[model samples]
Target chain A: GDSVTQKEGLVTLTEGLPVMLNCTYQTIYSNAFLFWYVHYLNESPRLLLKSSTDNKRTEHQGFHATLHKSSSSFHLQKSSAQLSDSALYYCALSDRYGSSGNKLIFGIGTLLSVKP
Target chain B: EAAVTQSPRNKVTVTGGNVTLSCRQTNSHNYMYWYRQDTGHGLRLIHYSYGAGNLQIGDVPDGYKATRTTQEDFFLLLELASPSQTSLYFCASSSNSQNTLYFGAGTRLSVL
Candidate 1:
């Protein structure tokens, strides 16, 4: 079985502050694909960043994450946070080659609130 | 852009009632999925289909049954709903199992 964990259920920060949302995963397979999906209020959840290669930082919309196979983690980080960045972030794992085909396992999600 | 549309943005039904959530993807993707969002639980996969007439059980499929009648259409059925079934449901489609998923606006279901 595969699973994702997001330890921080809520992370509030001031505008312009650094943003770091923790994410870790566990799977029996050696090769893993991790993803970050952002969900805004009243909007459909969309992909923000996806792991390209292990240890290679993948970034989009000022957010970046690196998949560390050694630690089984793909933590999302931003140098500065904006009020618009406030949303629910989910870390997920793609079990493409698993017995059940390509299924995505998501964490509990972290609500990132940025205040001015 | 990929588009996934779900009907009945809000639904309310009593326990033991029958409910069906519909989804259609114009992207013509081979894979479609049904997920439920709950507080402290994030999004949990209920069921998915890769193509017409195909159905695969997901992490939380105990109270759900899914049908893929066409390549663009997928449906989630709750024959006998329960209170615990109340949640926000999202439908998504991807070109393949490994690609990025495009989600629908979501349906909020309340089982009283």
Candidate 2:
């Protein structure tokens, strides 16, 4: 069984400060893909970033994450947090060729609150 | 942009009522999925389908059944809804098994 873990349920930060949301996963497959989805209020959740290459960084909309296979981690980070960045962040993992098809395992989401 | 549309943005039904959540994707994607979002649980997959007439059980398939009527449509059915089934439901579609998912606005279900 595969699983994803997002240690923080809620993270509050001041505007312009650095932002980091931790995400880790456990899977038996070697070819695993990690994804970050941002859900803003009153809108559908959209893909923010994704990576399958170990140690390579994937970024989108000022957010960046590097998939670290050695540590089984793919943490979302931003140099400066913005008020508009306040949203629910979800980390997901998928074993592209799993026996059960393309099933994605998701972690408990982290709600990022940026205070002005 | 990919479009995944879900009907009845909000729904309310009795505990023993039958409910069907509809989803239609215009992206022509081959993969469609149904997931429920709840506090502390993030998003749990209820079911998914790779194509028309295909269905796959997901991580949390209990009390739920899904059908893929066409390449662009998928439906989730809760034959006997319960209070525990109350949550925000999202329908998504992807071009392939290993591609990005386009999500619908979501359906808020309340079982009373």
Candidate 3:
């Protein structure tokens, strides 16, 4: 079975501070896709960044994540965080070869709180 | 842009009550899914369908039923709603089974 883990339950930081949210996964497939979905207070969850090739960094909206296949980790990072960047972030994995390859396995989301 | 709409932004029901949540996607996607979001649990798939008249069991399918009447419509049914079923439900659609998913605004269900 595939599973995702987000170790940080809450991350509070001041505006302009760097942001890093941890994400890891356990899957049997060698070629798996990792995704970062952002959810605002009242908005629908949307895709932020998706992994294409392993060990390559994917960036969107000032946020970037690098999928490290050797470590099975895809951590999201931002050099500077803004108040508007505060939201719930979910890390998900899709095993392209599994029976339920299309379905994503999500982690316990991390609540990012940015303060001025 | 792909649009996924879920009716009944909020719902309230009692134990042993019946409730149905509706979802519609105008993107003509072949795959639609129902997911529930809970504290400390992220989002768990309740049920999903690859096409009309097709059903696939998800990780948490107990105490719930789902129907896919058309490619654009999918419904989640709870015959005996309980307090444990109280959560934020989101419906999503993807062009393919394995692709970027577009989510709905979500429906908050409170079962007493």
> Taking the tens digit of each residue's C-alpha lDDT, what string does model 2 give over A2-115?
999999999999999999999999999899989999999999999998999999988889999999999999999999999999999999998884233567788999999999
Candidate 3, position A46, lDDT = 97
lDDT by residue (B1-112, candidate 2, tens digit) is 8899999899999999999999999998888999999999999999999999999888899999999999999999999999999999999988754468889999999999
Model 3 C-alpha lDDT per residue in residues A1-116, reported as the tens digit of each score: 89999999999999999999999999988888999999999999999999948888899999999999999999999999999999999999987632332688899999999999
Off by over 4 Å in 1: A97-100
Which candidate achieves the best DockQ against the true structure?
3
Off by over 4 Å in 3: A97-101
Model 3, range B1-112, lDDT digits (tens) per residue?
9999999999999999999999999998888999999989999999999899999999999999999999999999999999999999999998764478899999999999
Candidate 3: TM-score? 0.97
Q: What's the lDDT for residue A21 in model 1?
A: 100
Q: lDDT score of model 3?
A: 0.94
Q: Would you list the rank order by lDDT, best first?
A: 3, 2, 1
Residue range with the least summed lDDT across 10 consecutive positions in model 1 chain B: B93-102
TM-score of B-chain for each predicted structure, in order: 0.97, 0.98, 0.98
lDDT of 1 by residue, B1-112 (tens): 8999999999999999999999999997888999999989999999999899999998999989999999999999999999999999999988763568899999999999
In candidate 2, what fraction of native interface contacts survive?
0.54
What is the lDDT, from 0 to 100, of the residue B9 in candidate 1? 99
What are the clashing pairs of model 1?
A: none
Q: Which stretch of 10 consecutive residues in model 3 chain A shows the poorest summed lDDT?
A: A95-104
Give each model a TM-score.
0.96, 0.97, 0.97
